[model samples]
Target chain A: GIQVEQSPPDLILQEGANSTLRCNFSDSVNNLQWFHQNPWGQLINLFYIPSGTKQNGRLSATTVATERYSLLYISSSQTTDSGVYFCAVASVYGGATNKLIFGTGTLLAVQP
Target chain B: EAGVTQFPSHSVIEKGQTVTLRCDPISGHDNLYWYRRVMGKEIKFLLHFVKESKQDESGMPNNRFLAERTGGTYSTLKVQPAELEDSGVYFCASSQDRVGYSYEQYFGPGTRLTVT
Candidate 1:
């Protein structure tokens, strides 16, 4: 089984600030996704970057497959950004199903 | 297009009681999955369903958990005589493809279960 670890287990930031979260995997992965779990317990899909880089609004993510790590950047964060961000990956050896293995997550808080 | 949807936003039951959760994936999605986070732990895969067939269920905690996807539509997860350890948020996700080559999963609002 592959291990996924996320850094900065907890963070607090003022509104309009910027932040970066990192995820490190122990093995190569065929699938990787970043999610934001809002206070309402809704898991919102942020990005699906198995490799390379992509941006969506104020959020962006980059994954270095060779290094087995991913980075998520949040710029000009707003108070609504307060939530838990998760990075989940499915190892290349996971076979057909490729069920996701989730990280502990980074709890982000943005205050006004 | 509608995203994945789950039934019973929250459930509270006593230990040893039976409970069933339902998930309806997005239309046209062939891959449906179930995962859960227990006691503030990381979310773990419970199973995967490719249409009406069970692709994998290795993540199921024990025999008390049973999942079924009939007619290649909605899926149901039944827990017979649930235990306190089962208290957590259960999430259902669906993807348009087999989960590789850029196919991403869309999650439903989780169902929070509290077993007393």
Candidate 2:
């Protein structure tokens, strides 16, 4: 079983601030995704980056697969961005089975 | 386009009771998954279905939990004789493909199941 660890178990930022969330995996992965669990518990897909960089609105993510880690960046954060962010990885051995090993999660709180 | 949808946003049952949670994936999506987040724990994978076939069910906890995808459309997860430890938030997600191109998994709001 692969292990996924998220940094800064809890984070607090003021509105309009910027922050970075990090995820480290124990082994190489063929699939990695960033998800935001909204206040209502809807897991919103933020990015699917096994490697390289991708940007979506105010949110962006970069995964250094070789290094076995990923970083999620939120710019001009807003109160609505407050929620738990999770990084899930799919092992290459398991390949396309669709089973995702999720990190504990980074709990972000953006205060207005 | 419609996203993944789940029924009975919440459920409460006593130990030994049976409960079925349903999930309706996006119309054209071919992959559906069931995940659970127990209290104060990270989300854990339960199973995956490619169309009506169970592609991977390695994450299933035990025989008490059964999942089904009927006609390659909607899916259901039944927890029979639910135990106290079975209480958690169940999330259903669906992606567009099985291989290549990392597709985003659209998730449902989730069904909060409380077993007393």
The C-alpha stretches of model 1 lying farther than 4 A from their native spots are B98-101
* Model 2 CA deviation exceeding 4 Å by range: B98-100
Number of the predicted model whose DockQ against the real structure is largest: 1
Question: Which candidate achieves the best TM-score against the true structure?
Answer: 1
Per-prediction TM-score: 0.96, 0.93
Which pairs, if any, clash in model 2? none
Write model 1 residue lDDT over A1-112, tens digit each, in one string: 8999999999999999999999999999988999999998889999999999999999999999999999999999999999999999999899978799999999999999
True contacts kept of each: 0.82, 0.79
Q: How far off is residue B2 in model 1, in Å?
A: 0.9
lDDT of each: 0.94, 0.92
Candidate 2 reaches a DockQ of 0.73
